[model samples]
Target chain A: MHTATHSGALMAETTSTKDAEFGAWMTARQPALLRTAYLLTGDHHSAEDLVQTTLAKVYLSWDKVQKREVIDGYARRVLVNENNSVWRRAWKRRELVSDQLPERTGRHDSYDEGGSADLWAHVATLPRKQRAVIVLRYYEELSEAETAEVLGISVGTVKSQASRALATLRATAHDRLGLGEEER
Target chain B: MNHDHDDLAAQLGRQMRHEVEGLDRAPLSLADVKGRATRIRRRRAALTGAGTAAVLAIVVPMAMLAGQFTNAGDDVGPATDPPSVSPGPTEPPDQGPVVGVGESLDTADLPIGDVPAVTWLENGSVLHTADGENIRLEGTYEDVVRYDDGWLGIGGGLAVLLDADGAETGESWVTARNLATGQGGDVVLFVADGELRLHDNVDGETTVLRDGMPDTAEMIGVDDEDTAAYNLVGPQGEPFAALNRDGEETIPDPGTDAYVLNDVTEAGWVSAITQLMDDGTCSRTVAPNGDVAGETCELMFDRFSPDQRHVIAGPAYADGYGAGQLAVLPVDFTDGDDPVLELLQSGARDATLMSWGWEDDDHILVVTATPVDGSTDMTWQLVRIGLDGTVENAATPVRGDEFAFPFALTS
Candidate 1:
């Protein structure tokens, strides 16, 4: 009976320590994760919700995430996957709002919200797969391989998506940005 | 071909930075995040259990029948099927070093349109351009701040605000230091005399938003609602301050000599940060009611990201001047006692980073200057550094040689 009691106490201690460690990691890492989510979602509320969901999944598989060095990468992978799923569902339910500007339309004459509005608007017009490539490649600065791993796609797919996205931006915004026609 | 893309990337980066700068969303507390996450975990666990039970019911009966037939013929097979041999561990695939070839200038003749930029010239004048039209403001202004519609600068013995087209907004005031803007569209904050004051220029009326505060009170910043944050010395000489839409509420005094208020986040929480003499540099987010929410320690906090989640710091100060090291780290770093920093480019002597800005959530634009070998003048370079340690020289946002310094790259 004494041995069983001692073993029970040990189990409790181990569980407590594990919880503490997880809590500490979450406390320190949540803000960075939320910021990345905000960039991905372009809104604060949705970003927070996405991070919370990702963290919950990470918690469930904490034991499986054996390598401490890859925890950040693991979390990023979960985030990208979750974002892709959400984007798919959102696309399915998307309605055509008449007032919404077309992809080819340039900025209005009085629209000077800042230089960012045009760029961001153009980015917003991109397909989810293409946007994800641009964000992970240029914004998050992830390499093609890391971006592929995060999105569960091939490196070749990342490269192609990025190329297509850039071409579309150039075709649409070339005149608006006032760039010369000379090919580099 | 890649040069055009790089320029496009740089333009996109600037836009992302602009959007992030004025973001004023309240930060999530540790308890709040955990509570929501736990609820999600429980819901997911329930769904997973249901699915597992359904799968198990179907598999068990089938497996039992198969096992009986297989057992009858077990003697015909090698005794235990010779325990399956495991393969040796293999090396993980790596993509190797980051590509750095696309640093060349793009002289593409961009169409003549509104180029939103604030440019400083060699002759001590400011050039404001909107839609390819340039208007030059005469005077020697040291620096300029950009807003959505216009820019604020000091020139000709007065503070000035110019529209995107270079026309003066007819609002001018005495020059001040530490300029900041809040949600009050054209409203701006600056230090006057020994006190902090706000000058609102919206609707052609200039009004003083706040005045007559203690000289010891230094304005940290304002939030989305035009709320101001100040760090002031208490009556007992300890650090006491408050963040409020208006400074009517009583300021709370933590009564600790080691820490003082450094920043006020979007959620109105006060950040109690350490002083230089403290054992280690750190910042802790605390509730308005004086409850500590989270704490983070790091070597230094040169500047915080627009979202306030990460910080750019360096150990150059430790070497007493010349460029030593620069890195980006999460504000709440927790890899043992030592701060975990992703080191960017380093080892250049006598180089000083003058200004840095976020290009995106995980990318930074850093501007550095180094003294010329023979002359007192300094050469400036713009660099784009990523959290993954990808470093590349970036083309300046402004076009032409008329204006040398880039003040702001606007929409």
Candidate 2:
């Protein structure tokens, strides 16, 4: 009886210690994860929800993620995969909010403060896969190979998607935002 | 890269950084995440335990029956003595009168056969068989529907046309939202830039079907006759169904109550649903000319049978998640005769009918999960129920969670 009690207490102490370490790691990584998730979802509520789900998944496999350096990569993969699933299921819960179609306008018409918001809005309009590539390559600053690995696609796909997305953005910037005159 | 491209890439990175500069704090705490993890772990454990229990539930009974047969022979004679065979029963044990209509079989004695249809996702790819040929799609498609001689793979803001052998036919479309296909898969109807358009796969011609459609208009189903059905929000935000024949659209009024269009038949007949009471909804069939052809109360129909002669339906609401009573009703029924042909196999008081699809004209394929001894875990099996009330197993019973079954059994 005494041995059983001692073993139970030791197990509890070990679990508590492991949890504290995990908590500390999560605290440090939470801000960056939130930012990445926001860029992926293009909305604040969805980004938070995505992060929460991703963190829970990461915690489930915490023991397997042994190396600290590889943690970010592991979490990013989970985040991107989860977002893919979300987009797939989004149609089921879609609600028709308006009876009239919103009129299309140049991106710069609303955002005169700078062209950043316009560029962001245009980024949001890209296909989901292309958007992910741009976010990883330009925002996350991941290399082409790294972006491909994260998205489970070939490096060639990464390069092409990035190229197509950049071309669209460049054209939009020139046509709508009236910037990049030197390149022209 | 050129200097111009390099400058733009840098600028993009800067804009992204600026986008999230204000979100300084995370919304979730470590404790919150851990709590969610704990719940997920508990649920998985419960499911695993239930699976084990379901396996035992089947195995133990079979073992007992086998033991009974062995003992019966042993009781007839000693090892060295001449064995005197006892006469078998003259007639099979009388199972009470078969329930419902047609014929019935013991659920335990269902015959296993090849699955009629199968599709699944594997490692970011979609794989399915077309005409006994294995077809693989490596593109990022969220879903694919078998159409005409090929498949329509939709996702990543594009709809790809693949041949029967899964090769791209070099035809694709940029899809925004609300896409549907005809019963024969020959034509694709989609809403893009507030315009409803139809693409004829046969002629490879794209033409505008309707313009100035509300953003909320969703293409539900298109018939081989080129008639399309869609759901849209009314001026008061009430949901209503509309049909577009050729280039003209009409909002069919079955009555004062609004009905949501569920499906459209190849002949342009529509199956719709409307709330009849607080307890359940009612299903009705409407003709292409907006005439009320038939109606059945309390049951909501899902899809027409393969031959379009019958429809599979269920109660307006299931008692539990995936747990419900399913019935088959003839599409054409007179006022005096009974229409509901209750499926005896799905009459299980504790089983969950997870998913179902039409196997053929006469059989409906159902994936059923029976709870293991009142626990959360369940034993899964593929069952086929015939319109004549015959029930059989289409595959062996599997003991696991939903992940154990790889095929997209639900149509």
Candidate 3:
């Protein structure tokens, strides 16, 4: 009975330590996660919701994730999957409308000054999967293999999707600017 | 990787970083995440238990059947293999009603006229209809400016003039920036090394419009009266100015707030967003004489209609990551009158407004993702929305994971 009580106390202490570690990690990484989520969803409210859900999933799998160096990757995978699922679920349920308007944040310094706005606009027009690849590979600076793993696709697919996405962006840019044929 | 590809990748990274820079972290707490985690754990546990029970029930029956089959197999004519049947192709699931405002009609129901348009970037090629022929423009260009006699193809920091047949005319400008057509495309205006110059196609001469201009100055458009409008970005803010034939500057009073120029009309009217506060932003148009032509709150004017009678706008400071509501407001409006003439709500959730352009003086063509009633795949449809609240599908839907419609026109 004494050994059982001691074991119980030790287990509780270990759980508490795990919780503390996860809380610290969440606080430290929340901003970066939110930025990626915003890029994926394009709305502040939706991005916040996505990040919250992603962190919760991470917490539930903390035991497995804490032992690996791919915690960020795991969280990112959850984020991408959650975003895809949210859109699909919205379509299935036909409840896409949100009652509250998305909250507006302050304009970042040098916004749209460097012609990045046009590029970003074109990025928004990309398909969801292709867009995800671009976000992971370009915005997050993930390698092709890493992007493939995060998206659960083969590396060859990652390469093709990234290529197609870039091509589309170039073509769209020309079209937007009323430019003709791409220089060979 | 190619140089252009590398440049694009770098630009994309910079742009994405710029988008989220200075954005405040969301107010989420570890406690909130933990609470949600507990619920998720409980639900998953319940599901696991039920799944285990279901597996056991199936496994017990299968085990008994296997034992009986093993005992009787030798006498059962080698247990004649059950007729193997391959599963047929699974049909796409139904997605439900098409989401949009008002009645939805097929593209055939609309009135037909000559829809002379161009669709570009199909496998690195551009196709346009000219004189009833589908002409493909040769070579890839960074920017193209259409003129009455020829096209100006800008790439690799050089602006090469191309004839109507997409052939180079040997007229080119080096290091050109912000090239735009003025005086009904009879001339092209551009800034080169802080000098605003005009190239007259009729005279085959290049003349300097104004010197000592800021490098950030970009020619927006030119009015019929030989007036050119341009905007400059400085530390203070972005302020738009107009220059007439006599080289006089008409700098509009942008009030005391920073403003971003959206579009400038051929009539020298400027539409811009100002007062970008935390609450919201405001959009207004300034006339050539520094008068406030029209103004609207909580919305940013995207572009002027082809006739310049109305402006299509969306929510100000909107991330525009998804489909949202769009509104059309008359360019000429009183202070107290309602600015919105019509509001087009994106009816379905997850439907994104991909590309939009003025179809004609009375209609606007918007390409949006339409959910397939039962499948995960979405179809792109060209929607024609009229000023009088009429919406119709202007083209047959094409199934794809990406937006496939390529005939997006500049508004």
Candidate 4:
């Protein structure tokens, strides 16, 4: 208990030293940030990448964060940028592999025990933007504006992405997933 | 009654979250990354060891050459004369005072919106959505960008950027009642349309940023005196390609353009631009390296999700959250297996979707057609996809007429 208390102080000291505002900025925001990143990337690794990148970026701007408000907005923006860069590389790699000879499906998740195996199976099925939007808006409970901040977009854009994402999830829930029968 | 749909959705969220992996830094310390960053110190470290020596050898000549050119590349500070690329249309100097000169307003009764309509006005001026009757904000708003609230009692974790008279700031509208009580310190108003919009926060009155940038009002992060803003691209209404302050239609340089901004993580402002282009269906054109879509690579995704998942859509990362979901889709095994988003929820459907309608909160109106036999078109037969993460072949697909679209609900 003493160690916990001390480490809590240490953690605060470290983050505060890194960016005095960061301790105040993301006091209890790690878990939530992780969740938001997870939803956006659909992969835990990618989500963590986003969160860490955000933290690092926040560290650099510790002063502005404390002097001005909206430190959270700044951090969220960094996370969104990191996530986008990831898929940009992915899309680029996909382009390079577009010409590769087709290989038979050998690693389908139907047999994988990893819960994420199935979760990602569904997430991958979503368009990248909607998936990111969904995680920020619904899971993290950020409003359209906040989501936009993390993602660096307009409120209108948030509404549009959410609408599109909702529709797709709804449809997939109904037909492919047969969600209606379960609710009965 | 099976509550499997809710169970599955919740489970998926939980499991997927639990399964996430963090960035493997291996053996680096937080101190290490910091040390590395400190070593680089931006432009100072940009000059490489070899490049530094090479420049040293030619430093005398380069300095003389630099004198000829207006320090195009100065001591890593803002250059006096940046290399000009394609020039854009130039407008006359902004013809207005940068700040309000003792202008006053009695915001106590500024016709602000009441509860659940127009949100309270920030700085005791302007009406927010809390009181707006059907999204009413009078005349031309030069620009707008949204911000995520770190739970600061702003608008649902985010604040809408304010652009009027050429000034830029971010604050959410409050209800009439909340405005009276005050949100925080001096309302810490920012610049709007070249005017000062102040706010009161825990701290006393603070003038955030002044005369920030012209025609380039955006969500700017300030460091010391260096502040970079992500320019809002693709002006709405008229489609005249905006020129930067220099009146250059094309981007000043590759980095300034707002295309594929989401793709560049180093630049912190990409998320803001991402949302601007992410206006539901507004498409953005930018390269992965965060270059202008026009020059580097013209790749863009929907500003919003395109009612279906099959089409190659990028993550709406640079924008906000609250949109996107999981759906059970019939595995498409065709020539170009683009999985069409079937109806599971009305919210997810694009306004243009015909085969989908809403059934309830979690489910939507679905139209299935005999599993789309070879060469057959997807017809209107509504079905349900559950959230249980279970898939069972439909016994019989339903008809489209049994559905209802709120008419107001369109992609």
Best by DockQ: 3
- The candidate with the higher lDDT, 2 or 3, is 2
Residue-by-residue lDDT tens digits, candidate 3, B1-411: 556667777788888998999876857898888877786665455333432342233232222222221232323221122212211113422442222332332333333333434332221135343234444556545445564476766544455667777777777656343466655467777765556777677787877777777644555666555555566655422243444454666444434444455665554455665434322345675443344546555456656765566666665534323345565666644234544333444344334555455665566767666556565456666666666555556545567643233333321
Report the candidate with higher TM-score, 3 versus 4. 3
**Model 2 chain A, poorest ten-residue lDDT window?**
A93-102
Best by TM-score: 3
> TM-score ranking from best to worst?
3, 2, 1, 4
Best-to-worst ranking by lDDT: 2, 3, 1, 4
What tens-digit string does per-residue lDDT give for candidate 2 at B230-285? 87776533567777767787666534556566667555555666432222345565
**TM-score of model 4 relative to the true fold?**
0.31
- Per-prediction DockQ: 0.07, 0.19, 0.20, 0.05
Clashes per candidate (backbone, < 3 Å): 13, 0, 13, 103
lDDT of candidate 1 over B270-312, digit per residue (tens): 4444332211234444332233333444334444455545555
Encode model 2's per-residue lDDT on A17-114: one tens digit a residue.
77887788888888999999999889887788888888988888887878978988999998886675444222221211110112223222222337
| Model 2 lDDT on a 0 to 1 scale | 0.60
Best by lDDT: 2
- Residue B341 of model 3 has an lDDT of 37
* Residue B105 error, candidate 1, Å: 20
Error of 3 at B192 (Å): 6.6
